[model samples]
Target: MEFSRRAFLAGTSALAAPLLLAKCGFVGGGGGSSSDDADTLTFTTWGTDAELAGFRAAIAAFGEANPGQTVELNAVPYEQMFTNIDAQLQAGNPPDLFRVPYYTFGAYAGQGQLLDLGPYLSADTQDRFTPAAWAAVQNEGSPFGLPHHTDTSAVLYNRDLLTSAGITTVPETAEEAWTWEELTGVAQQLRSALPADRYPFAYNWQGNGVTRWLSLLFQADGAFLDTDQRTPLIDSDAGRAAVEFSSSFFSNGFVPANNTTTSASYASEAWFGGTAAMVWSGAFQIPDAETTADFEWGATFAPRNVRGGSDFGGNALVATAQTAKPELAAAFLEFVTERDLMADFCRSASLLPTRADLQGDALTFDVRPELAPVFAGQAATVEPEDAAQVASPFMSGIIPVLQDQLDQAFLGSQDAAAAVTAMAAGIADATR
Candidate 1:
């Protein structure tokens, strides 16, 4: 949830280092002997202030429920979490449990640094989660973690701008989403109506912006990696089309010329400042928009080319391979993910819930009632196949390469076809 350009760039460099010496057997460290000391479990996560407070409160509740158990919360800055965890794992002393992003879940699971949660989960429990959220935590065929929370992407539009531009019909549902061409036509109309300094779209090209590209790729019916996750499929025709379509917005002046600058808040800034009519970004923007913007605004699924899809971003709770008490760790995971508890966490943290059943009914943020359904709809409608593309372990390696190529394409240093080919080559080399 605390994604920043600096943090993501730092993580790319840190993740390239080896985290584990080798894969070992599944059995974890033995549970501590029954002394007078309470069973101590460590939970490592990254966040500050309000986010950290939410985790601490949840852990305190868990401790109170299970009287003699004590769970220590280790809070790290977002930029240092991976490096810190990698060092702990290599030292053979990781926290009993930790929170990890979906992209890194595959890498840790592949190296056998995470406990397999598949055996611990019941069918009914698994069914409680949205399918896409459940699939995001799996490595190969096994689950290494439980889906904690999710954030999906959508198109945030200025209702006043649309209305001023004579656009009466705006997409309110996935089924009624605009096509790429239709969106372009609308942009053109806004361009004529708005001031010259304002653009029609605000494209985020920093931090987890690669996920934005993944959404466009999926919408074009392209996969980032093959089913095996060993081969790169980013050079396909659909992939080329996705990149080309995205680049065209900037090249044609539909988006700001400086859109490629690496600022985490650029998208929101542009929208709130009235420099742009729309922003394709995550659901996290909903809270910010409600508090900052004076104009009438609404959200809907991003424009569809071949199909409707959005970037899936979130973290999951996993038991470490070095946990001394697997049962206690699993219990903590369940406690945090409990239906009512998770709803509270999501509302307090201003995040999207992972549970399909709780999304609409349990969400309590009352600031933007209309936008809630849009975020919930995007979260619930994630295609299982599209989620699988993002869940690939290969993505952790391919992301840096893809980001570089995307920057080149956006800056006109490379053509979309050439950039796609370079991305494919880079991914192939990384997987090998």
Candidate 2:
């Protein structure tokens, strides 16, 4: 639990010795004359071409507006981020500023590796975001990060297929909703369009597919782990139902027999080819939908699980100890997070801004009009289900358990109750 400043600083100078001469180009160069002021601050991120372009333009704008300061950026590839970041941080320094996906927020912020900026945001500036998102991103009292943008999971459904099937738009209200059985039944009815080797839904894996399933649990009033966060409750009745819920899709011919997936482009192929009626994904998945669906396509909120919550996410900005200019880092955060900048970044990034009012703004709706349902759904709900935070190391270690153990249930190979119970023990040990 200790910050261990000495352990962090011990080899920094020696490891940094060779890089001192060229550190300006690599680390950003303006650590001011003062000890805490650095000449440069580094940043890192990985993403869409449009989003990256916007980020670079924003950085350039920031540097130009402040002649003495510079922002050196490294857009780390998604596949290589873990490897590169591990080596960089363990070394003398890492990035001054960086993006932390929600999946990793709990781990980093809980560990004290990130600098706190809660006080900085408290000034009349903090009123814009959804409070649930704020709690979701903050750790303890210190705000380790501020959300950059957010998008929740939804069912991207094919309208022509639904209309052809005699169904209208996605159910307007959650209560008029298709319960799990009805959802699968509809998939069975639509399965006629599927050819050999494909079924109804395409699953892109995350948290071994458990997090996605957790939305069901949320609707059912079940939690991923107990309140203490020590054990995963995925083996319980509701947990089993969540598992049973997904299993029904695969078994009932509603979803493809996913044991041997040949391609990750399930979303593109299934929907485009008219092989599947819907797949679950976020707004970032919209651009692909735009290009791929041959018929009218639309997205609707994740069906309400019995308990009534949906999956939610937001990109958070963090300041790492690697920056010598913490003050500048904080200022830049303020600048980018300013409502105007956030709106611009969200537009290009194919995301919703963290600001509540912007959700209804004309410009946002204009860019991704299909997302009106999404905006409305999120605004209607005051709280997103709480997220499960694992330590950084625990993330890598537990993911396989999700895929191998938890997914086995969804794929029909293992009992959901048994598989989920096994993972709970592993989570406890690894977390300790």
Candidate 3:
């Protein structure tokens, strides 16, 4: 997770252009003008060069296949994407189709800004997606988007480091996966065996870090929100244990003192620099790790407690409610998400496809041979039951409060039980 300078430049440029357009009162194609023309469709999304390239290839393929239809792609930087889309929708000029982060889909759909896609979905199309994939875009028994691609988190370890710590076997399957206590014991061993600067474990300790925490809560058989998704459940017994287990890593010095301030790049640096033995990260890191690391590394399921589950994070395609050409937008969405095109896109972009059938080795295993199965295995653990319980519109609003209280517990300002209780209280207030 090193952010390339090119990505930063592209993000800044994309960010500035939208603000300039808003300041000039130039509402581009508001009031559904762009979607009214059957020959053309506007699609908005954000990605890096590789992702944009994959998308462009798909768009070109769609144009060639449809013969008179033109698909225009508007790609922004990842950082400014959601804000820019919010602005465009507010100005009443959203693209015919746009990318939605699964977690935020509920917020926009709840506002009646996105088209309910249930009518457009057929049995055949629905069958193409995995249950977890389909569950990600639905709200209150209606579909708002179509699945694009997905990924789940896993623990990547430095094999050489582990072997040096007198560990011969690494957990390769869920049946053999380490428990939280077992993982902490191994981390302790590595802490003593490694150099003074090295820590035992690290993760992306920003917003994504909060996702990892949620996974831990699930592994402890806890829920963030109740079955209705409107009630806060962060004060449950499982929640307290999850928080205490996580806070101990920091309090016991298994994690660095400056972890809260550390960025993803710093964590990657520690892992790649051989100062850290393992990283709790998503499957997207496999390609980068294979390219840069000199030492041998492997990935496995995230340590399990009572049960195991991983966070399924990805983007999906949705049509705006203002789209005048609903059929055309739906066609384009189907075109890009078709089985062959999606498989190619996932292969080219090094992403995990949302299709259950595409989980074969022919796509990613050929590239990063060692780590692909671990990712695939982790993805298999992301069940529809977990999605129904964990994914919520309130999540976007409550994450900041949850993160703040967790940080306080980690830094010793509040005890774990108190922090968990406060987080639940804060979420209850927000939802009310």
Off by over 4 Å in 2: 1-39, 64-67, 124-126, 173-177, 192-198, 206-210, 259-269, 360-367, 375-385, 388-394
Look at candidate 3 and tell me the lDDT of residue 74.
93
**Which stretch of 10 consecutive residues in model 3 shows the poorest summed lDDT?**
15-24
Per-residue lDDT of candidate 1, residues 1-432 (tens digit): 111324322322211111221111223345432112336678889963656877888888887787667778888888889898999898877788889888777788878889876555544556678777876776766667888988877888888888888987788887778888988898888888888899998876566556667888888877777655557788888889998988888887898877763544667678889899898767666677877889988877777888787777878899987676666666678778888778777776667888878867566554575576777776665766566556677667877887888878988999989999999899888788
lDDT against the true structure, each candidate? 0.74, 0.60, 0.74
lDDT of 3 by residue, 20-117 (tens): 11111112232463555556788888885667888899899987877777779999888888898888889988888889777777777777888776
lDDT per residue, candidate 2, 338-408, as tens digits? 67777777776677677656665433643456575564464344352354332132454555555566556
Q: Residue 168 error for model 2, in Å? A: 3.5
Superior candidate under TM-score, 1 versus 3: 3
TM-score, ranked from best to worst: 3, 1, 2
| Each model's backbone clash number | 0, 17, 0
- TM-score against truth, every candidate: 0.86, 0.81, 0.88
Compute the lDDT of residue 34 as modeled in candidate 2. 22
